[model samples]
Target: TILSSDAYQRSWKPNETNQQDERNFSRMVVRRLPAEVVADAITQATASNTRVTAMTSSPTDRTIGPDILAKNNKKLTSLNYTLSVFGKPDRTENCDCERSNAPTLLQAVFTRNDPSLISMINGSDRRAKGWIAEVQEWYSGKTKPTNQANGNKRLKQLNDQRKKLLAKAPKKPRNTRDAKATQRYQLTIKKHREAVQVLNRNISKLKGGRSNGNLVKRQITALETDKLINETFLRTVSRMPSANELNMARADINSNQDKIGGVKDLLWTLLNTKEFLVNH
Candidate 1:
């Protein structure tokens, strides 16, 4: 029951509150990360000076964007990032593994963004300078990570809840009737705000909740407001792009513009990049 989405709803009480209790309720939990050790192991492995910094409620807590000067000629061929739930892939044969990985990964990655850089074997090791390298090495197996043993213990017990997807002889009958992809398919991602416009326009006809047109209009208004917020965020992010990014982007487009023409080329590039995409 504690894990249920509605669990806290039932537990709430309208009791008189003290200021101390209020402060206590608002305090954030501090959990140490196993990724710290992973970072250390990577520093040990790569022999490149890098460190991970932790997250704090400050703008200064950002670490290392991709190197702006990183060359197109030297573009990384095998860049990969892998982290599984608390119990990673192959940690355990249990039902709870997949259920637990996402939050764990978020926390681990968050903690990794902050670490104390104690020593510099190579060049000066600024605290966050080496983090990308450390993370890359850890995920790519410079050193063995810590969660595997603990996660494995619960695998069988948790996975017993569901049959393995890859089993050649599935333990139970398959449900094929609901397969949504009836053909070799194409997935079209229409612009998010653009795609939702139809729903917003006709929201009044679809009925739910406690009110009539008034309530539906309020919900649609909220969604549209959210769309505006997302646009604002993306615009702000785009404005902060590195100084030379536009020049580099233009260079890439010069080759293609002759084939597709300039107006469409500019439109496609801006629409497809981080500058225009607001992801949360």
Candidate 2:
């Protein structure tokens, strides 16, 4: 539905009644840029400043205006251009696509332990501790026990409540008074049934989370299972590289091996690339 709406807006034309349609359409997609994008932009700005300073000391830096910078550093220039164009706009237009929901901050905090995926910054421990405490408090306040025994007890209680409600319902709704009472009883019965279903689903999820091993061993098993599934899916869906592409990749690897100072530098470069940095 969102994609369809976006397509409609793209092809929509303005008439006298919809003279401000373009302005209204522009408000449809409000999304926060990815965290990796923000980080990359910061890095690029710092690098650009350093280059500008170094170049200013020489004679060639004076020629690099906005247009010249755009030609040489297209990615950086485009980023700047986009920011300039969309920095702040009118928000009066009512659009369905208001904002892009990103992963919660707590989810990001939990990701610090995965070194291969993300490297945690300094003071991450303090932040993670605060986030964990907040999450624990919230969970305690909101969630009930989802273990098997508790789930069964809750379901039984709900079923008893439903039966009691159903028994109170008028068998023959001959008048408006009987109909109203029967409707109320039916509503109460429906609520109890829904609660029972929710409890059953929660119990299933709790059992799935538990495993027959110590915490560390269970984690290792989960990681291995996840890796196997990912590899299998990639192999099934991804096409093999062409011979020319393979040769080019090998040549690029050899060049990097020769040029890079050490494994650390090579790994850093690989990890900082857009492909590796972005969360899929």
Candidate 3:
């Protein structure tokens, strides 16, 4: 039977052949066995009265020579015969390996603005939601729900009362009694301001204590880095000229507008192309 490597080589034309062959010899079989199944088979073979030998390539070397195979056999007494062959094609393809139909987990995290990717990472399950909530709490450095709510309510009340008092206070003192009233009003404003300041300090402490402040700072830094990377990528892409524009420039077509929608058509074509669709 022709091996998968041979089949692949034969399927492609001479001109289409890659500079370096990329075939997976291990996956040549019609039915690929699981690692556990293969391990079990090896174990059973070893226990049998009949001698058995298995051939495999070295981690760094794709090809195995007869001398190397003999050297390996000297270290093991269980195998009766071993014939390791050289010239097996390496699996690595010469083409862009980064290309993919969808973004990976790390990619999704880096591009945090994508709602679809974020939703996928977060998941729809209750357990996932709980974990997400915990992460959000840590990132935000938020206080206890009840305390946050109460603090905000009190702050609002103080602000509202202060505003009301300020609005009702006399603009100018007309007499000694009026001046005394003005002084009292000023003292009341100062008292309210001090109370507001104290509440704000308490709220700050409650939200981000020393224990979580470092973690919050690190999260902010990571977010800022990602934002910078995203902005740089956007700027680079915006400055790049499309294939249609390049072609027009070559032809000395200086027109800024597309008369036959050539640019649009070229854009659509490029978008659908495998080169553009791939991540690379």
Best by lDDT: 2
TM-score of each: 0.15, 0.18, 0.20
Q: Tens digits of per-residue lDDT for model 2 on 225-268? A: 33323322222223344557445434443455321122122233
Write down the RMSD of all candidates, one decimal each.
26.7, 22.3, 23.6
**TM-score, model 3 to reference:** 0.20
Give the top-scoring candidate (TM-score).
3
Ranked by lDDT from best down, the candidates are: 2, 3, 1
lDDT of 1 by residue, 60-84 (tens): 3322223232234332211112222
- List pairs with backbone clashes in candidate 3: none
Residue 241 displacement in candidate 3 (angstroms): 58
* Candidate 2: Cα lDDT at 189: 69
Q: Model 3: per-residue lDDT, tens digit, 1-280?
A: 5565666556332233343444644222222232223222322221211111222222321121223443554332211111101112232677544323232454323223333222322322111232223333444655345555676676566567656655655444456578778897778777766766665666565455324323342243434433322322222232345556455533332242421132223322332233332322
Cα lDDT listed for each candidate: 0.32, 0.38, 0.35
Error (Å) of candidate 3 at residue 149 is: 3.8
